[model samples]
Target: MDKLRSLTLFLATCEEQSFAAAARVCNTDPSTISKAVSRLEAELGVTLFQRSTRQLKITAAGRHYAQTVRSSILALSSCEDELRQLNDAPRGRLRVNSAVCYGHLYLRPLLKAFCQRYPEITLELSLDDMHVDIIEQDIDVALRTGFVKDSRLVARCLSPMDFVVCASPDYLKQHDMPVSLDDFNGHSWIGFKIKETQQLQPIFLPDADGVYQLCELHRTHITDDGEAMAQLCADGFGFAQLPHFLAKAGLKSGALVSLYPAFRAPMPDSGVFAIYPKRAYLPARVRVFLDFLVTALEAQQETPTHTWAQHWPPHVQFD
Candidate 1:
């Protein structure tokens, strides 16, 4: 008289409406099935079945109990299946998409280590500046910067997107360094044009009240590519506002010098995000890769040379 075995027999009896048929389903004799149900009824102090010579009728209470027990058993079975899937070695082709500069500068370097760690996962990475439909492309995951507007995707913020207004040392030598926002009027500016929209990307700067406001500057040079913009700025084109990922290398190498140290661009919907299609059960390969990427980025943040976001002046630090 195991409780679960009794419940299973009760459910089968309720479904079959006959002890003999239930016995057939349970691969036991009718008398054994009847005894199990009788034991369950005795324990619950409720007559589950209205047994007659010709008909075996289930009571309303028996019907309700059967429904509840069936649901519980199904849930338990689903949990067990999920656990088995998790325990299995993750193996699959993991298709990942990313923005061009981010893929090249940040993600490309980590692929070798990721491949070594998860040898079973076949990694397919595609880099594009324009956002692509992941579902249509069958992409498993995508690394994106700035806001994720699609309601169909789940976006996990990996890091904050910080922008630095900087110029190369050679450019700084030729042009007078601006001490204030007003002084920027006389300085040349390099701008990034959005390839998708064919419009110049707006530059936002924090005001005295720490409110971010869009600032319009005369563009001396413009490019659709972030890396190209960073390069132009580094080669003495002009001062440009560059994302931290694109500017980190130059800043560390002294090829670029940050301007307006106290000012920061706190733009809304600005962050580094790992995006994937919304799903009830995320594949193990995608899940492991996401976990690996997060850990790798955290380790990078701890090291001075490989930190994704730059540490500004102590007074201007923000979480």
Candidate 2:
């Protein structure tokens, strides 16, 4: 029972009084923790905790078990730390997840460098636009964009990818250019859809007379792929809004044009971050990848699109 994680978590649940709180401390799911506790109660054939809708009260056996588990876990960690000190290098599989556009547009190069740095570290990279359960998925770290919400993981800001309003050169030349936000009403719009929601997301832009308004978008073409939107917009389909960093190359190479230079409103909360489970010691692989990502993003910002335009293709290299 002492060697089993379910038993250990059962003790943690009784001590914490809440399954969610124990899950956070142990870096697991709340449901998993609760199930473990329930299983422990069934196996022991004693009601370890008195459960009510309002609170969980620990029985005498629960308190005794919690105390015993706490001391034993601590002792095990102390023993493990001495052996870990002898192995200076962190050699393990480091799993990472990121948005598809962000992953290809940014981290591919950075990850290449990271793999070079730590030859022993195996990377399992998953690219998806939707939010994922890092702990449950066994993800070591994630490079995420926009707002950071989870308190269970520690977030480190890597960079801010500024957003912009864009349209195809041909489309802008064919139609009357929108002078202000209210001007958007007359234009055919391409929008981004969050896959998890399967609904169109609002793209905030300055409305009539240059007043920023979070307008509900009525999109003619809405898709989950950011690249698809950009491509469709480039093909003179409709105006699409995208991150400035993403459009910078297209804007330079005469593929896409910034719709409103002055009114390309960037949201204040759109900070890119690297999130990871809260651990006592961050593994070297995670640190190395984060450092590489920061360096790559900073270099991208410092060197203008024209600098890369001469060497690299104008549109997305990967997609």
Candidate 3:
């Protein structure tokens, strides 16, 4: 007989006080229970029970053994329960990545609420603008702005990359705000340079025909950092077209002023997206985080329609 099975049968027989009764409880024959307990007593070199034809009574050794093994049995049952919970609930270390500005401005606040709701989930978040290989870096989810070209990954749109032209109050006070596209001709511009291509990031604006056009601005100051460009714009360095994530608060607090509220930029594919690797079964934690992020970002916007404008033409580009 197996040792664990023998121990269980022995304990049941001891507690029930009769082999026949223990067999009834265990759904086994009385002879099987009798043999298992006899084997257990032999292995332990202890007389566990004193049996007579009329009644069966447990020895002192049998009572002591039952008391000792009861705690171990309870602990084993508790471990099984924990394993079951691990399979059903979202409770584990979750790795996530996001761009610096968006992480700080939007994701940072949402994290507190998410943690509070799911206290069992441990989160590891990395905030940076540098491109990362999610598989290589072991990242479970990534919040990025712009095109997601990797076929190995699945992308979900979080918000539109609505470019808004803004300038510091000091700069606008010193120089007139550009009301038309032509007014940008001689103004000092703070621009963004592509890190990989080393070329000026294309500025998309509308033409006289209401169609979108791209103009590569000649910049007096350029950087590959989004936050730096926004800061320079706020510090009165020059005018910059910044994403709403970086420019919204400054515009509201009067540190920066928006130019041409009616004109919208053309960025069909340049939207904030959450990317994750293609997998047959995505973890429960990742799915919950992605859904929570979308809800949190929407709460900060004026309206869903305004946050994602639909007037831009489909895949329009300029050579």
Better of 1 and 2 by lDDT: 1
Off by over 4 Å in 2: 1-87, 207-211, 262-268, 302-319
What is the Cα-based lDDT of residue 190 in candidate 2?
Answer: 91
TM-score of each prediction:
0.68, 0.67, 0.65
| Candidate 2: tens digits of C-alpha lDDT, residues 125-233 | 8998887867555577887766557776787776555556777878978997665556677888998887877877677675445555688757888778888878888
Once fitted onto the true fold, the runs of candidate 1 whose alpha carbons sit more than 4 angstroms away are: 1-84, 206-212, 262-266, 302-310, 313-319
lDDT of 1: 0.78
Clash pairs of candidate 2? 181-206, 181-207, 182-207, 182-208
Error of 1 at 307 (Å): 7.4
What lDDT does the true structure give each of the candidates? 0.78, 0.70, 0.75
After superposition, the stretches of candidate 3 with alpha carbons farther than 4 Å from their true spots are 1-87, 177-180, 209-211, 262-268, 302-319
Ranking by lDDT: 1, 3, 2
Tens-digit lDDT string for candidate 3 (1-319)? 7787887887778667899999997899999999998887888999999989999999999889886675455456446545565566766778899888888887887899999988888999998777887754557899888655888688887766777667787887798656567777779899887675687777766666655578756788998888889899999998787877777777767788765342445556667888987664567777788877878777776232356322322221212
